[model samples]
Target: METNLTYEAAYKELTEIAQEIENESVSVDVLADKVKRASELIEFCQTKLRATETEVNKIIKQMENQ
Candidate 1:
Protein backbone atom coordinates (compact mmCIF):
# COMPACT_ATOMS: atom_id res chain seq x y z
CA MET A 1 0.00 0.00 0.00
CA GLU A 2 1.37 3.42 -0.86
CA THR A 3 1.15 6.07 1.84
CA ASN A 4 0.96 8.92 -0.62
CA LEU A 5 -1.76 7.66 -2.96
CA THR A 6 -4.53 10.15 -3.47
CA TYR A 7 -8.17 9.00 -3.48
CA GLU A 8 -8.51 9.56 -7.23
CA ALA A 9 -5.45 7.52 -8.05
CA ALA A 10 -6.50 4.61 -5.88
CA TYR A 11 -10.01 4.70 -7.30
CA LYS A 12 -8.69 4.74 -10.87
CA GLU A 13 -6.45 1.80 -10.18
CA LEU A 14 -9.28 -0.08 -8.59
CA THR A 15 -11.53 0.59 -11.56
CA GLU A 16 -8.85 -0.61 -13.95
CA ILE A 17 -8.33 -3.76 -11.94
CA ALA A 18 -12.05 -4.47 -11.95
CA GLN A 19 -12.28 -3.97 -15.69
CA GLU A 20 -9.33 -6.26 -16.31
CA ILE A 21 -10.83 -8.97 -14.15
CA GLU A 22 -14.27 -8.56 -15.65
CA ASN A 23 -12.88 -8.76 -19.16
CA GLU A 24 -10.81 -11.83 -18.25
CA SER A 25 -7.70 -10.10 -19.45
CA VAL A 26 -5.55 -10.67 -16.39
CA SER A 27 -3.37 -13.74 -16.46
CA VAL A 28 -3.73 -16.37 -13.76
CA ASP A 29 -0.15 -15.86 -12.64
CA VAL A 30 -0.85 -12.30 -11.50
CA LEU A 31 -4.54 -12.51 -10.60
CA ALA A 32 -3.89 -12.85 -6.90
CA ASP A 33 -1.58 -9.86 -6.89
CA LYS A 34 -4.16 -7.76 -8.71
CA VAL A 35 -6.89 -8.80 -6.31
CA LYS A 36 -4.75 -7.87 -3.35
CA ARG A 37 -3.97 -4.50 -4.84
CA ALA A 38 -7.66 -3.90 -5.49
CA SER A 39 -8.48 -4.69 -1.88
CA GLU A 40 -5.92 -2.19 -0.68
CA LEU A 41 -7.21 0.46 -3.04
CA ILE A 42 -10.80 -0.11 -1.93
CA GLU A 43 -9.83 0.25 1.70
CA PHE A 44 -7.86 3.38 1.01
CA CYS A 45 -10.73 4.90 -0.97
CA GLN A 46 -13.25 4.11 1.76
CA THR A 47 -11.05 5.65 4.41
CA LYS A 48 -10.52 8.76 2.34
CA LEU A 49 -14.26 9.18 1.73
CA ARG A 50 -15.08 8.79 5.40
CA ALA A 51 -12.49 11.33 6.41
CA THR A 52 -13.71 13.77 3.80
CA GLU A 53 -17.30 13.35 4.89
CA THR A 54 -16.38 13.97 8.50
CA GLU A 55 -14.42 17.10 7.63
CA VAL A 56 -17.20 18.45 5.46
CA ASN A 57 -19.78 17.87 8.16
CA LYS A 58 -17.60 19.61 10.72
CA ILE A 59 -17.17 22.61 8.46
CA ILE A 60 -20.88 22.79 7.79
CA LYS A 61 -21.59 22.73 11.49
CA GLN A 62 -19.17 25.58 12.06
CA MET A 63 -20.81 27.62 9.34
CA GLU A 64 -24.29 26.98 10.75
CA ASN A 65 -23.20 28.18 14.18
CA GLN A 66 -21.51 31.31 12.92
Candidate 2:
Protein backbone atom coordinates (compact mmCIF):
# COMPACT_ATOMS: atom_id res chain seq x y z
CA MET A 1 0.00 0.00 0.00
CA GLU A 2 1.46 3.33 -1.03
CA THR A 3 1.18 6.14 1.49
CA ASN A 4 0.66 8.51 -1.42
CA LEU A 5 -2.74 7.09 -2.38
CA THR A 6 -5.41 9.75 -2.10
CA TYR A 7 -8.60 9.08 -0.16
CA GLU A 8 -10.79 9.42 -3.25
CA ALA A 9 -8.59 7.04 -5.25
CA ALA A 10 -8.51 4.47 -2.49
CA TYR A 11 -12.25 4.77 -2.00
CA LYS A 12 -12.89 4.33 -5.70
CA GLU A 13 -10.74 1.24 -5.78
CA LEU A 14 -12.46 -0.17 -2.77
CA THR A 15 -15.86 0.36 -4.35
CA GLU A 16 -14.75 -1.33 -7.51
CA ILE A 17 -13.38 -4.28 -5.60
CA ALA A 18 -16.56 -4.62 -3.64
CA GLN A 19 -18.61 -4.56 -6.80
CA GLU A 20 -16.45 -7.26 -8.31
CA ILE A 21 -16.85 -9.42 -5.26
CA GLU A 22 -20.56 -8.89 -5.09
CA ASN A 23 -21.03 -9.57 -8.76
CA GLU A 24 -18.84 -12.68 -8.57
CA SER A 25 -16.67 -11.31 -11.31
CA VAL A 26 -13.46 -12.08 -9.50
CA SER A 27 -12.00 -15.53 -9.95
CA VAL A 28 -11.48 -17.69 -6.89
CA ASP A 29 -7.74 -17.86 -7.50
CA VAL A 30 -7.30 -14.09 -7.19
CA LEU A 31 -10.01 -13.48 -4.61
CA ALA A 32 -7.56 -13.50 -1.73
CA ASP A 33 -5.38 -10.91 -3.40
CA LYS A 34 -8.36 -8.67 -4.11
CA VAL A 35 -9.55 -9.03 -0.54
CA LYS A 36 -6.13 -8.07 0.80
CA ARG A 37 -5.96 -5.03 -1.44
CA ALA A 38 -9.48 -3.99 -0.48
CA SER A 39 -8.59 -4.26 3.19
CA GLU A 40 -5.55 -2.06 2.70
CA LEU A 41 -7.60 0.50 0.77
CA ILE A 42 -10.25 0.51 3.47
CA GLU A 43 -7.66 1.17 6.15
CA PHE A 44 -6.09 3.91 4.11
CA CYS A 45 -9.43 5.59 3.53
CA GLN A 46 -10.36 5.36 7.21
CA THR A 47 -7.06 6.85 8.34
CA LYS A 48 -7.34 9.65 5.83
CA LEU A 49 -10.91 10.40 6.86
CA ARG A 50 -9.98 10.49 10.55
CA ALA A 51 -7.05 12.82 9.89
CA THR A 52 -9.23 15.13 7.80
CA GLU A 53 -11.95 15.17 10.45
CA THR A 54 -9.44 16.00 13.16
CA GLU A 55 -8.01 18.84 11.11
CA VAL A 56 -11.47 20.18 10.32
CA ASN A 57 -12.49 20.07 13.96
CA LYS A 58 -9.33 21.88 15.02
CA ILE A 59 -10.02 24.62 12.52
CA ILE A 60 -13.62 24.89 13.64
CA LYS A 61 -12.56 25.20 17.28
CA GLN A 62 -10.09 27.89 16.39
CA MET A 63 -12.79 29.79 14.51
CA GLU A 64 -15.11 29.55 17.48
CA ASN A 65 -12.46 30.80 19.86
CA GLN A 66 -11.76 33.78 17.63
Candidate 3:
Protein backbone atom coordinates (compact mmCIF):
# COMPACT_ATOMS: atom_id res chain seq x y z
CA MET A 1 0.00 0.00 0.00
CA GLU A 2 1.23 3.50 -0.79
CA THR A 3 1.32 6.10 1.94
CA ASN A 4 0.44 9.72 1.40
CA LEU A 5 3.13 12.16 0.29
CA THR A 6 5.24 13.74 2.99
CA TYR A 7 5.22 17.50 3.50
CA GLU A 8 8.76 17.88 2.16
CA ALA A 9 8.05 16.08 -1.09
CA ALA A 10 4.88 18.02 -1.76
CA TYR A 11 6.56 21.32 -1.00
CA LYS A 12 9.51 20.45 -3.20
CA GLU A 13 7.30 19.69 -6.18
CA LEU A 14 5.31 22.87 -5.66
CA THR A 15 8.51 24.84 -5.54
CA GLU A 16 9.80 23.26 -8.70
CA ILE A 17 6.61 24.11 -10.57
CA ALA A 18 6.77 27.68 -9.39
CA GLN A 19 10.34 27.96 -10.55
CA GLU A 20 9.49 26.55 -13.95
CA ILE A 21 6.58 28.95 -14.33
CA GLU A 22 8.83 31.85 -13.43
CA ASN A 23 11.26 31.06 -16.24
CA GLU A 24 10.42 33.19 -19.31
CA SER A 25 11.16 30.46 -21.82
CA VAL A 26 7.93 28.53 -21.29
CA SER A 27 5.27 28.94 -24.01
CA VAL A 28 1.87 30.60 -23.39
CA ASP A 29 -0.23 27.56 -24.29
CA VAL A 30 1.85 25.19 -22.18
CA LEU A 31 1.80 27.64 -19.29
CA ALA A 32 -1.97 27.31 -18.92
CA ASP A 33 -1.72 23.55 -18.86
CA LYS A 34 1.07 23.69 -16.35
CA VAL A 35 -0.93 26.04 -14.15
CA LYS A 36 -3.93 23.72 -14.27
CA ARG A 37 -1.78 20.75 -13.30
CA ALA A 38 -0.20 22.75 -10.51
CA SER A 39 -3.64 23.66 -9.20
CA GLU A 40 -4.64 20.02 -9.11
CA LEU A 41 -1.45 19.08 -7.33
CA ILE A 42 -2.04 21.80 -4.79
CA GLU A 43 -5.53 20.48 -4.12
CA PHE A 44 -4.23 16.95 -3.76
CA CYS A 45 -1.52 18.09 -1.37
CA GLN A 46 -4.05 19.94 0.70
CA THR A 47 -6.32 16.92 0.88
CA LYS A 48 -3.45 14.66 1.88
CA LEU A 49 -2.28 17.09 4.52
CA ARG A 50 -5.74 17.25 6.02
CA ALA A 51 -6.09 13.49 6.01
CA THR A 52 -2.71 13.07 7.73
CA GLU A 53 -3.72 15.55 10.39
CA THR A 54 -6.97 13.71 10.96
CA GLU A 55 -5.21 10.37 11.24
CA VAL A 56 -2.70 11.76 13.69
CA ASN A 57 -5.45 13.11 15.86
CA LYS A 58 -7.22 9.77 15.86
CA ILE A 59 -4.02 7.98 16.86
CA ILE A 60 -3.38 10.43 19.66
CA LYS A 61 -6.88 9.93 20.96
CA GLN A 62 -6.46 6.18 20.90
CA MET A 63 -3.15 6.41 22.73
CA GLU A 64 -4.69 8.58 25.40
CA ASN A 65 -7.42 6.02 25.94
CA GLN A 66 -4.95 3.17 26.41
Candidate 4:
Protein backbone atom coordinates (compact mmCIF):
# COMPACT_ATOMS: atom_id res chain seq x y z
CA MET A 1 0.00 0.00 0.00
CA GLU A 2 1.24 3.48 -0.76
CA THR A 3 1.34 5.88 2.17
CA ASN A 4 1.34 9.00 0.00
CA LEU A 5 -0.92 7.84 -2.83
CA THR A 6 -3.05 10.48 -4.48
CA TYR A 7 -6.71 9.99 -5.31
CA GLU A 8 -6.07 9.93 -9.06
CA ALA A 9 -3.35 7.32 -8.69
CA ALA A 10 -5.50 5.15 -6.44
CA TYR A 11 -8.40 5.43 -8.83
CA LYS A 12 -6.20 4.58 -11.80
CA GLU A 13 -4.86 1.52 -10.01
CA LEU A 14 -8.35 0.43 -9.03
CA THR A 15 -9.49 0.69 -12.63
CA GLU A 16 -6.53 -1.32 -13.83
CA ILE A 17 -7.18 -3.99 -11.21
CA ALA A 18 -10.81 -4.21 -12.20
CA GLN A 19 -9.85 -4.58 -15.82
CA GLU A 20 -7.28 -7.25 -15.02
CA ILE A 21 -9.75 -9.21 -12.95
CA GLU A 22 -12.43 -8.83 -15.55
CA ASN A 23 -10.06 -10.07 -18.21
CA GLU A 24 -9.05 -13.02 -16.02
CA SER A 25 -5.46 -12.09 -16.50
CA VAL A 26 -4.46 -12.56 -12.89
CA SER A 27 -3.67 -16.06 -11.74
CA VAL A 28 -5.32 -17.53 -8.63
CA ASP A 29 -2.25 -17.05 -6.48
CA VAL A 30 -1.94 -13.36 -7.29
CA LEU A 31 -5.69 -12.74 -7.51
CA ALA A 32 -6.12 -12.52 -3.76
CA ASP A 33 -3.36 -9.96 -3.46
CA LYS A 34 -4.82 -7.89 -6.29
CA VAL A 35 -8.23 -7.98 -4.70
CA LYS A 36 -6.79 -6.92 -1.35
CA ARG A 37 -4.97 -4.02 -2.94
CA ALA A 38 -8.11 -2.98 -4.79
CA SER A 39 -9.99 -3.03 -1.49
CA GLU A 40 -7.45 -0.70 0.07
CA LEU A 41 -7.56 1.62 -2.93
CA ILE A 42 -11.35 1.75 -2.74
CA GLU A 43 -11.22 2.68 0.92
CA PHE A 44 -8.59 5.34 0.28
CA CYS A 45 -10.54 6.81 -2.64
CA GLN A 46 -13.76 6.91 -0.62
CA THR A 47 -12.10 8.66 2.30
CA LYS A 48 -10.44 11.20 0.04
CA LEU A 49 -13.70 11.93 -1.77
CA ARG A 50 -15.58 12.39 1.49
CA ALA A 51 -12.94 14.70 2.93
CA THR A 52 -12.84 16.76 -0.26
CA GLU A 53 -16.61 17.00 -0.33
CA THR A 54 -16.74 18.15 3.28
CA GLU A 55 -14.07 20.75 2.68
CA VAL A 56 -15.83 22.05 -0.43
CA ASN A 57 -19.11 22.30 1.43
CA LYS A 58 -17.49 24.11 4.30
CA ILE A 59 -15.89 26.59 1.95
CA ILE A 60 -19.19 27.15 0.20
CA LYS A 61 -20.91 27.75 3.54
CA GLN A 62 -18.26 30.23 4.53
CA MET A 63 -18.64 32.09 1.28
CA GLU A 64 -22.39 32.19 1.76
CA ASN A 65 -22.01 33.56 5.25
CA GLN A 66 -19.65 36.33 4.14
Candidate 5:
Protein backbone atom coordinates (compact mmCIF):
# COMPACT_ATOMS: atom_id res chain seq x y z
CA MET A 1 0.00 0.00 0.00
CA GLU A 2 1.15 3.54 -0.69
CA THR A 3 1.83 5.78 2.27
CA ASN A 4 -0.53 8.71 2.68
CA LEU A 5 1.02 11.94 1.49
CA THR A 6 0.72 14.91 3.84
CA TYR A 7 -1.59 17.73 2.75
CA GLU A 8 1.32 20.15 2.69
CA ALA A 9 3.32 17.99 0.30
CA ALA A 10 0.37 17.41 -2.00
CA TYR A 11 -0.58 21.09 -2.05
CA LYS A 12 2.98 22.12 -2.78
CA GLU A 13 3.20 19.69 -5.70
CA LEU A 14 -0.11 20.98 -7.11
CA THR A 15 1.07 24.55 -6.85
CA GLU A 16 4.35 23.74 -8.56
CA ILE A 17 2.61 21.97 -11.43
CA ALA A 18 0.22 24.89 -11.91
CA GLN A 19 3.07 27.32 -12.02
CA GLU A 20 4.91 25.22 -14.57
CA ILE A 21 1.83 25.05 -16.77
CA GLU A 22 1.42 28.81 -16.53
CA ASN A 23 4.95 29.38 -17.73
CA GLU A 24 5.18 30.15 -21.46
CA SER A 25 8.51 28.34 -21.59
CA VAL A 26 6.84 24.98 -21.08
CA SER A 27 6.51 23.12 -24.37
CA VAL A 28 3.07 22.05 -25.58
CA ASP A 29 4.20 18.45 -25.87
CA VAL A 30 4.95 18.32 -22.15
CA LEU A 31 1.57 19.71 -21.19
CA ALA A 32 0.00 16.29 -21.40
CA ASP A 33 2.42 14.90 -18.80
CA LYS A 34 1.87 17.87 -16.55
CA VAL A 35 -1.89 17.49 -16.85
CA LYS A 36 -1.68 13.85 -15.91
CA ARG A 37 0.41 14.64 -12.84
CA ALA A 38 -2.00 17.39 -11.86
CA SER A 39 -4.95 15.00 -12.09
CA GLU A 40 -3.25 12.46 -9.85
CA LEU A 41 -2.36 15.14 -7.32
CA ILE A 42 -5.94 16.37 -7.33
CA GLU A 43 -7.23 12.88 -6.61
CA PHE A 44 -4.78 12.53 -3.76
CA CYS A 45 -5.83 15.85 -2.31
CA GLN A 46 -9.52 14.93 -2.57
CA THR A 47 -8.94 11.67 -0.74
CA LYS A 48 -7.10 13.47 2.04
CA LEU A 49 -9.84 16.06 2.31
CA ARG A 50 -12.51 13.37 2.56
CA ALA A 51 -10.58 11.54 5.25
CA THR A 52 -10.23 14.76 7.22
CA GLU A 53 -13.93 15.49 6.93
CA THR A 54 -14.80 12.04 8.21
CA GLU A 55 -12.47 12.49 11.19
CA VAL A 56 -14.00 15.88 11.99
CA ASN A 57 -17.50 14.40 11.85
CA LYS A 58 -16.48 11.62 14.20
CA ILE A 59 -15.09 14.14 16.66
CA ILE A 60 -18.23 16.23 16.53
CA LYS A 61 -20.41 13.20 17.12
CA GLN A 62 -18.32 12.17 20.11
CA MET A 63 -18.56 15.62 21.64
CA GLU A 64 -22.32 15.65 21.23
CA ASN A 65 -22.60 12.34 23.00
CA GLN A 66 -20.83 13.69 26.09
Candidate 6:
Protein backbone atom coordinates (compact mmCIF):
# COMPACT_ATOMS: atom_id res chain seq x y z
CA MET A 1 0.00 0.00 0.00
CA GLU A 2 1.22 3.52 -0.81
CA THR A 3 1.63 5.97 2.05
CA ASN A 4 0.44 8.90 -0.05
CA LEU A 5 -3.01 7.52 -0.78
CA THR A 6 -5.57 10.33 -0.64
CA TYR A 7 -8.90 9.95 1.10
CA GLU A 8 -10.85 10.07 -2.15
CA ALA A 9 -8.69 7.39 -3.77
CA ALA A 10 -8.93 5.13 -0.72
CA TYR A 11 -12.69 5.63 -0.58
CA LYS A 12 -13.05 4.78 -4.27
CA GLU A 13 -11.00 1.63 -3.89
CA LEU A 14 -13.05 0.64 -0.85
CA THR A 15 -16.26 0.99 -2.78
CA GLU A 16 -14.93 -1.12 -5.66
CA ILE A 17 -13.71 -3.79 -3.27
CA ALA A 18 -17.11 -3.90 -1.58
CA GLN A 19 -18.85 -4.34 -4.90
CA GLU A 20 -16.48 -7.11 -5.89
CA ILE A 21 -17.05 -8.91 -2.62
CA GLU A 22 -20.82 -8.51 -2.81
CA ASN A 23 -20.91 -9.87 -6.36
CA GLU A 24 -18.55 -12.74 -5.50
CA SER A 25 -16.21 -11.72 -8.25
CA VAL A 26 -13.03 -12.17 -6.22
CA SER A 27 -11.43 -15.60 -6.36
CA VAL A 28 -10.68 -17.48 -3.18
CA ASP A 29 -6.94 -17.04 -3.66
CA VAL A 30 -7.23 -13.26 -3.72
CA LEU A 31 -10.12 -12.83 -1.30
CA ALA A 32 -7.93 -12.41 1.75
CA ASP A 33 -5.78 -9.79 0.07
CA LYS A 34 -8.83 -7.85 -1.01
CA VAL A 35 -10.29 -7.94 2.50
CA LYS A 36 -7.00 -6.77 3.97
CA ARG A 37 -6.80 -3.90 1.52
CA ALA A 38 -10.35 -2.91 2.36
CA SER A 39 -9.48 -2.86 6.05
CA GLU A 40 -6.51 -0.59 5.42
CA LEU A 41 -8.60 1.73 3.28
CA ILE A 42 -11.32 1.86 5.91
CA GLU A 43 -8.81 2.77 8.57
CA PHE A 44 -7.32 5.48 6.41
CA CYS A 45 -10.74 6.94 5.68
CA GLN A 46 -11.73 6.88 9.35
CA THR A 47 -8.53 8.64 10.39
CA LYS A 48 -9.03 11.30 7.75
CA LEU A 49 -12.62 11.85 8.83
CA ARG A 50 -11.65 12.22 12.46
CA ALA A 51 -8.92 14.71 11.62
CA THR A 52 -11.28 16.72 9.43
CA GLU A 53 -13.92 16.77 12.13
CA THR A 54 -11.45 18.05 14.68
CA GLU A 55 -10.30 20.82 12.38
CA VAL A 56 -13.86 21.81 11.58
CA ASN A 57 -14.73 21.96 15.23
CA LYS A 58 -11.77 24.19 15.93
CA ILE A 59 -12.75 26.52 13.13
CA ILE A 60 -16.32 26.72 14.35
CA LYS A 61 -15.18 27.48 17.85
CA GLN A 62 -13.03 30.31 16.56
CA MET A 63 -15.90 31.70 14.54
CA GLU A 64 -18.22 31.57 17.52
CA ASN A 65 -15.68 33.33 19.74
CA GLN A 66 -15.38 36.16 17.21
Question: What is the TM-score of each predicted model, taking all chains together?
Answer: 0.95, 0.94, 0.76, 0.96, 0.85, 0.94
Model 2: per-residue Cα lDDT over 2-58, one tens digit each: 858888889999999999999999999999999999989988888889999999999
- Candidate 4 residue runs with Cα over 4 Å from true position: none
Model with the higher lDDT, candidate 3 or 6: 6
Model 2: lowest-lDDT 10 consecutive positions: 1-10
- State each model's C-alpha RMSD to the native: 0.7, 0.7, 3.3, 0.7, 1.8, 0.9
Q: How many angstroms is residue 39 displaced in model 2 relative to the true structure, after the best TM-score fit?
A: 0.6
Candidate 6's C-alpha lDDT?
0.97
Total backbone collisions, model 2 = 0
Off by over 4 Å in 2: none
Clashing pairs in 2: none
Which candidate do you rate higher for TM-score, 1 or 5?
1
Error of 2 at 38 (Å): 0.6
lDDT of the candidates, in the order given:
0.95, 0.94, 0.79, 0.96, 0.85, 0.97
How does candidate 5 fare on TM-score? 0.85
Model 5: CA > 4 A from native: 1-4
Model 6 spans with C-alpha error above 4 angstroms: none
Per-residue lDDT tens digits for candidate 5, residues 7-37, read 7898898899899888765689998888888
What is the alpha-carbon RMSD of candidate 4 to the true structure? 0.7
Q: How many clashes in each candidate?
A: 0, 0, 0, 0, 0, 0
The digit string of per-residue lDDT tens for model 6 on 1-66 reads 688989999999999999999999999999999999999899999999999999999999999999
Best by TM-score: 4
What does candidate 3's lDDT look like per residue over 12-39, in tens digits? 8777888988886668879887787778
RMSD (CA, Å), candidate 1 to true, equals: 0.7
